[model samples]
Target: MIRLHHVAQTRSFRVLWMLEELGLDFDVVPHSFFDRSLRDPAYLALSPAGRVPALEIDGRTLCESGAILQYLAETRGTLTGTPEERPDWLEWLHYAETVGSHVANLTQHHIILRDPAMRSATVMRLEAKRLEKALEGIERRMAGDWLLPSGFSAADIAVSYGALIGQRFTALDRLPKVSAWLDRLNARPAFQRAAARDGAAQIYMQAFYPPPEETPHA
Candidate 1:
């Protein structure tokens, strides 16, 4: 049986959406970032870093979400894209983390820090700008409806996770293609299914977390 450890609105959502896209029958082992459950020894055994998206499949467990997506696509013989497009596919897949890093920093400053004093307005503004630039790269690279010219592939599912969440910290107004692409992704049936199973909002209580206003230096 395939089992996926998931937390709503986390990077694990990438794996959850991927599983739905592949039409795989799997159980979602729900987890929370608020509770100390992730720190437990049992969960850690599955994910050494105490992170989400730890998947149990084919008699072995996988931790990283990107790796899981590649394994599933290759083993299932679908969504891997054409062999000639492998380089682009792999590049987009890993680039998801570039977008994610900014989101993580923004989330930490905007949400996880709890006390306002503990959060750095400078970091928030900087990360938001960085996230916006990363998304701009996606917009510039979009020559079609999806990341790859070969149509929808696992690369879309892998990288879109960041765009989906990054919007909270960074506006997509100028990135029209990225916004349109996100709309198309949200309209997918598999993406809808994953959203239904995404559990409750344990994090990101606000609809939008705007970056702090820029301080003018004298």
Candidate 2:
């Protein structure tokens, strides 16, 4: 059975959601965020980064959320796009990873990482602006849905987690196409089941409402 090392509110959600899409039975291994237990020596053996969403599939371990999604999609053959379309496919993947990484960093440094007395104002503002630009770029590319010309591939899965979960940033209002895409993704039965299994409905709901902007630099 496929076992997913899941940490709630992390990129692991994307893996869980994809497993749901595949209709495959899997086990969810829980991990905590407050500590680096995930980075323990044994776990690190499987995932050098010591991050969540590591997968143990029939005794083979795999890490990195993006790689995990691509593996599952390829194994199940639901990954659309071919070698002829490889350029666009790889482009979409990079776009997803690039945007998501920037946004997540912004969220972490600006919002989640708090030491009110020692916060870096300049870093906060810079990350926020960078995140804004990244979102704008993503919106432009997604004007035509599904990331690539082929529609609904692992590329979408890679990007959707950030789009779906980045509540600390601005809402998806300006990016109506991406906003609509989020709604459409949530509507899928697979998404629903995965969310329920992961018990992430409340977290997903919370993501819909953006928190008040509290830029330390401002």
Candidate 3:
């Protein structure tokens, strides 16, 4: 049986969406970031870092979302992209983390740090800018509806997760291409199925978390 440890609105959603795209039958083991369940020993055994997207499949477990995507694609012989496009495919897959890093920092400052004093306005603004820059990269690279010229592949699923969630922290007003790409992704039947099962928002409750307004020295 394939089991995916998932937390709604987290990177785990990448794996969840991938499974749906592959039309695989799997079970989602729901988890919560606020509940401290991730710190438990049992869950820790599945994911040493106490993070989400730990997938159990083929008698082994994989924690990293990109790795899991590659494994599923390679083993399933689909969504791997043409052999000639492997280099671009790999680049986009790993680039997802570049987008994810800023998202994590923004999420920490904007949400996890409940106390206003504990949060840094500088960091929030900086990360949001950095996240915007990352999205800009995608906007520039997007020559077509998907990341690759070949067609939709796992790379789209991997990197689009950041764009989907990153918009919460960064504005997409200038990112017309990225915004359009997201609209296309959201319309996919598989993405719709995944969203239907993605449970409810636990981490990102706000529609937008703008950076703290800048202050001027008198």
Candidate 2 residue lDDT tens string, 37-135:
886898888788888889998569988887787778777887646667767766766677776776676566554666766556566566656666776
lDDT score of residue 146 within candidate 2:
67
Global Cα lDDT for candidate 2: 0.72
Off by over 4 Å in 3: none
Instruction: Indicate the residue-level lDDT of 180 in model 2.
Output: 81
* Model 1, CA-based lDDT: 0.93
Worst 10 residues of 2 by lDDT: 200-209
**Please, what are the lDDT tens digits per residue for candidate 1 over residues 1-218?**
99999999999999899899999999999989989999999999999999998999999999999999999999999998889999999999999999999999999998899999999998898899999999999999985999998899999998898899998888888999999999999999999999999999988888799988877899
Candidate 3 backbone collisions, by pair:
none
lDDT of 3 by residue, 90-193 (tens): 99999999999999999999899999999999999999999999999999999598899889999999999999999999889999999999999999999999
- In angstroms, give how far residue 105 of model 1 lies from its true place: 0.6
lDDT of each: 0.93, 0.72, 0.94
TM-score, prediction 1: 0.97
Candidate 3 TM-score, true structure as reference: 0.98
Query: If scored against the real structure, what TM-score would every candidate get?
Result: 0.97, 0.84, 0.98
Clash list (residue pairs), candidate 1: none
